[model samples]
Target: MAADPVVSVDAVSKVFATRAGPVHALRDVSFSVPRGHTLGLVGESGSGKSTIARLVLGLERPTTGAVRFESVDLSAAGRAARKRMRRRMQMVFQDPYSSLLPHLTVLSNVVEPLRLHGIGTVAQRRERATQMLVRVGIGAASAGFYPRQFSGGQQQRIAIARALVLEPEFLVCDEPTSSLDVSVQAQILGLLQGLQRDLGLTCLFVSHNLAVIERMATEVVVMCGGRVVESASTEELFAHPAHPYTRRLLAAVLPLEGDAPPLPADDWDPASLDDDEREVVRISPGHYLRA
Candidate 1:
């Protein structure tokens, strides 16, 4: 049998009440993240990728349905339980400059998580934090420098160090390399892959870049307009995209031989779709596509 999932989002729906109207950010979205596996969530801007990330992190509660970490429902958890759960799961944001403390040195920022969780003694935390920095390619000597002193890539390295310092079992990365240069993007991706392998971490990697997702993800979920249009193992999804939206997304990113694949002019209209009907269909044992 397959191992139980470390993270599970079960028929989750999220609606945000904006002044304009009620915005449905997620619609019965459900997926389980197997331990030691990376699940890539790919979609364009305003596609609700970040909303799902927030729900998984327990930073935001779903309007309906459940978000579970280690089989514990976040929405139902008490404050103390939730706090303990949050420590096992960490997040790495796209903008490391904004995420890291501007006033604190890299060393202090990295050790902050450990200190908050009361993971180790001051000496042990410093040593572990320094080691994490070194693992991310930042030397101990540079740890004293502030965020502004380091380059964009270095700042991200520090952020990654901070996230990993606590030895988190799960990681939620929201476009973590999007802000970096092409060269630096590759470096960060490589570092993340290496760290995941070394630590046996389960990850939810959210990105708009299909190429990045293709490289980092073992399995992929393709979202469009707050719904999952397709989900499959990385190789299968790239080779055969079952949903129209997923195909359009692939065509936009992957190059074709002679001419570009023609996409439907009609934008995804939620009003046209029937919520009562099955929106997603199983194409194979493990692969699913929007019906």
Candidate 2:
């Protein structure tokens, strides 16, 4: 009797075969993004955060388990079904410069998905793209400019416009603001927050910055070593971090002037943890911690 999640990753694991051996990119990861909410995925490099993004988008098949979108199992969907599912989901990558084609004009870049999906007439597509650009704070006059002509923030705005023009119900934002200046990042974050609120979008926002996650996410999933170390509502997780890794991560957040540095790593060592501590333990309602 409950509505299905917009996106769901269930017991998913990804192992990439390399020359040396199989690299386990993800390990039995499970999470869900409900409609009209943002699920923040935070972790350091090599934490398998990006792998989760790829799995949800069906860009990579899981070695084990499933990724479902709109109650459709993406890994098992046929080509046509997968394509149809893709139309309802979109992604915003970290680097805007590389995401937008250098040769295409800004307007063309934004409308590219519409044209590819055959969503509307040429005129209609143009009109829609123009409106989206304006919504992201880019004026209609600059729509003709090339990606290189814009600053880093502007390029990211263009990328956001492109991703949202399709009006997708789910958005996977992979460090979408990490490349911009602090001021620009704030603007982009504000824009995303506004867009999500107005459009009732469900988002999976990936970033390493806890501060940013605190600002944007309704729920947070903290990952480490290809596994989710902690999952909770933003407020609860920040207030009470049960996992040593989670505590270490929070300690590492840069502080203001005169604030002390994070405690040393020797204080909390994963190598010393027991097996039960390594498993996800429910701390309270809607909160889980890896001991």
- Total clashes in model 1, counting residue pairs 3 or more apart in sequence or in different chains: 0
- Candidate lDDT values, in order: 0.88, 0.89
**1-291: candidate 2 lDDT, tens digit per residue:** 014678889889899999999888888888898788899999988889999999999999999999999778998999999998898899999999999999999999998999999998999999999999999999999999999999999999999999999889999999999889989999999999999999989999999988789899989999888888899999898887777787787787876568556544437655353233357778898899776
Model 2: which ten-residue window has the lowest total lDDT?
269-278
In the range 35-73, model 1's lDDT, one tens digit per residue, is: 999999999898889999999999999999999998899
- Pairs of residues clashing in candidate 2: none
Q: What is the lDDT of residue 49 in candidate 2?
A: 97
Cα error, candidate 1, residue 198 (Å) = 0.4
- Model 1, CA-based lDDT: 0.88
TM-score of each: 0.93, 0.94
